[model samples]
Target: MKAAVLYARNDIRVEEKAVPALEPHEILVKVKATGICGSDLPRVLGDAAHHYPIVLGHEFAGVVERIGFGVSKVKVGDRVAGVPLKPCFKCQDCLSGNYAQCKYYSFIGSRVDGSWAEYVAIPEINAIRFDDSIRFEEAAFVEPSAVALHALQHIRFEGGENVAVLGGGNIGLLALQWAKLLGAREVTVFDIDDDRLASASRLGADHTINAKHPDVEEQVKRMTDGKGFPVVLETAGSDVTMRQSFELAASKAKICFIGTPAGDITFSHKQFELMNRKEFTLTGSWMSYSAPFPGREWELTLHFLKQGKLNFKELIFRTFPLDEINEAFDLYRTPGAVKGKLMLLPG
Candidate 1:
């Protein structure tokens, strides 16, 4: 089997390696498609560190080629998507139904070898079965979409509030659709990329504002009649947008921070005062999770994709074979590439 192995920062190569052996609790999946995520950027770029010689890809889906001794939830040849990880049922967090808070878990893409090769092993507890009707390409997205869903659910939303989403990247775009489906009165998206903002508009944002524009804050104020959006989601992972979230949210608004900021973020006294004065309620969301492995976040995302409700297929951007993984990363790192989710076909 051939795998794209990251030897070091900026040194990823496609090389032959023995196929992974299956564990009694695991299943072998013939990799069909996998998607690159925003986090993949820092790891590949050397800004954020990752273990050397890793096969980095977690947002993936495939067909079951072989199942280990104890696997039963999925049989041979079943189409499925593997959750990036599974929690230890014995952990205090897992036992308490807070799977996301599990102190220790094996993350397929980062913690272990992932689906950037011909086949990857996944624990049965982390596998979600998809039907033949869903395209492998679409199924590959279940992971990230589940992350978006988990963020929203973590906020304890019951719907009918207006939402302001900062960042129109894949996660932000997915957040817009999820907000609408959850019955948000209106969904507004903010981003520096007009193209992404356009995609957000197509996806059903009532308004799309380029965060770089000088008038963006004023425009948002006018749109909200100075009251500000009741729900604010910061997904850009930038200090600027993180602070803007405080300025754009209404008094007592629920703010969800889903993006992993590139570095330390500081708030000036005046800027921090906005949150204090407005009583903004902020929650930081990590990787999506729930009890029973991926929980409802993973399940609901699959349901939405299967029903054709959460559509982003047109943004598949580009596809490449395992051999072209290097080029794929180059394109992904390129600015203004009209790229959405870069897919790899390991075949």
Candidate 2:
């Protein structure tokens, strides 16, 4: 087996490695398509300070080539997309259905070897069985789409509410689509790049704003009847956008921060005063929980894709073979690419 191993910053090599051995209750997936997320870039640059010599890819989907003992949820030849989080279910947070908060929570790609290879061994518990109708490229998106859904669920918006999503990257675009699916009357997406803003419009944003332009906040306020959006989601992970998020949200509105900012942020005292006066609810949402809930949002996202309600095919801007993983990373890190999601295909 061959895997793209990251040994240090800007040094990812495709090296031959022994195929991962499957553990009992685990399944071996023949990697088909894997998406490079924004987080992968920082880790690759050594900015995120992750362990070296790691296989980096969590947003992935593939065919089940083999199954471990007692793996009954899926069998050989089944198509699957999985939640990467593996948690100890006995922890207090896990027992309370907060799997993301579990002290022992860890994910593939970041902490462990991920899907940047010909094969990966995943616990059967994280795998979600899908039919052959779903393409591996589309199924590979289920992980990030699940993250978007989890953010939306954390906010708990009412029907017919307006939303402003800052950033037009993959997560922001997915958040726009999920907001519509959840019955948001209007979604306004903000991005500095015109191309990304255009992509966001195609994904289902009612309005698009270029944050680099003057009076952006005023423009957003006017679009929302001068009351500001009830829900403002920051997905850019920039300090500028994070600061502006508070200014664009209405009184008593809910703000969900989905992007991971790389460094500390500074805000005005007046912004906190407004939040207090408006009784605003500020929250941060991380990755999806592993524990089963009554309405699995990931399953719902799959259903939406299956029904043609959510179209993400256009979001895929480029695909590269696993051997060209470094080139793919270069393109991802470059500015003005406007590429939504880059897929690494492994055969």
Candidate 3:
């Protein structure tokens, strides 16, 4: 099998490697498609990887080639999407059905070899079978879709109120769609890029704002009649958008920060004071998971994809063959190089 092995910072090579063997509860998947995630950027370029000579990719889908002795949930030839989190089932958090909170969790792609190769072995429990009608590329998006859904679930969203999503990246776009699906009276997306904002509009966002504009807040105020959004989700890890979130929230609103911050953040007296004045319920969301292992986040993502309610195809910006993994990583180097998801065809 061939895998993209990262030997050092900014150094990734597609090389021959032995195929992974399955454990009793594991299954061998012939990886068909995988996606490059935002979290993968620093690990590949900033020396953030856990170790050297690692295979780094987690968002993926493939066909089952073989199942181990105890595998029963899925069978050979079943098309499935991979769940990357491997929580220690015995941990107190895991026992309490808070798998994402488990301190003893090992993530695929980041903590171990991931689906960046022709063949990868994963626990059967980590595989979510999808309808055959769904394309491998769409199935590959299940992980990110789940992440977007999980973020909104943190706010206990009941919809019918105005919602604001800060950022128009893949996750942000998905968040906007999920907000609409969950019954938001209106969903607005904010971003610095016009192309991304256009993508948001195509993905069913009721409104899109270019956050780069000096009067962006005024525009938002007009859109919401000055009350602001009752639900605010910040999916751009940028300090600018993170700071803007406080001002975007309505009084006593529910706000969730889903994007991971890349650097230290400091707020001014007036900026931080908004939270105190508004009395909003601010929360931070982690990786997608809940009570029953992989949880409803993963389940609902697949369901919506199968029903054609989710727009997975339009979110893909480009696709590269596994042999061109290095080139794919290079695309991220150029400012504003990618507008949406970048996919990899391992087969």
Model 1, 148: alpha-carbon shift in Å? Answer: 0.7
Residue 33, model 3: lDDT of 100
RMSD of every candidate to native, in Å, equals 1.2, 1.5, 0.8
Backbone clashes in model 1, listed as residue pairs = none
| Preferred candidate (lDDT higher): 2 or 3 | 3
Q: Which residue window of length 10 is worst by lDDT in model 1?
A: 330-339
Local accuracy of candidate 2 as per-residue lDDT tens digits, 14-133: 999999898899999999999888888888876573688899899889989999988898989989886677787888988888888879967888888999999988998878878877
State which candidate has the highest lDDT: 3
Evaluate residue 175 in candidate 2 and report its C-alpha lDDT on the 0 to 100 scale. 91
Higher-ranked by lDDT: 1 or 2: 1
- The TM-scores, one per candidate, come to 0.97, 0.96, 0.99
Model 2, position 120, has a per-residue lDDT of: 88
- The alpha-carbon lDDT assigned to residue 142 of candidate 2 equals 89
* TM-score top scorer: 3
Task: Write down the worst ten-residue block by lDDT for model 2.
Answer: 288-297
Model 1 scores a TM of 0.97
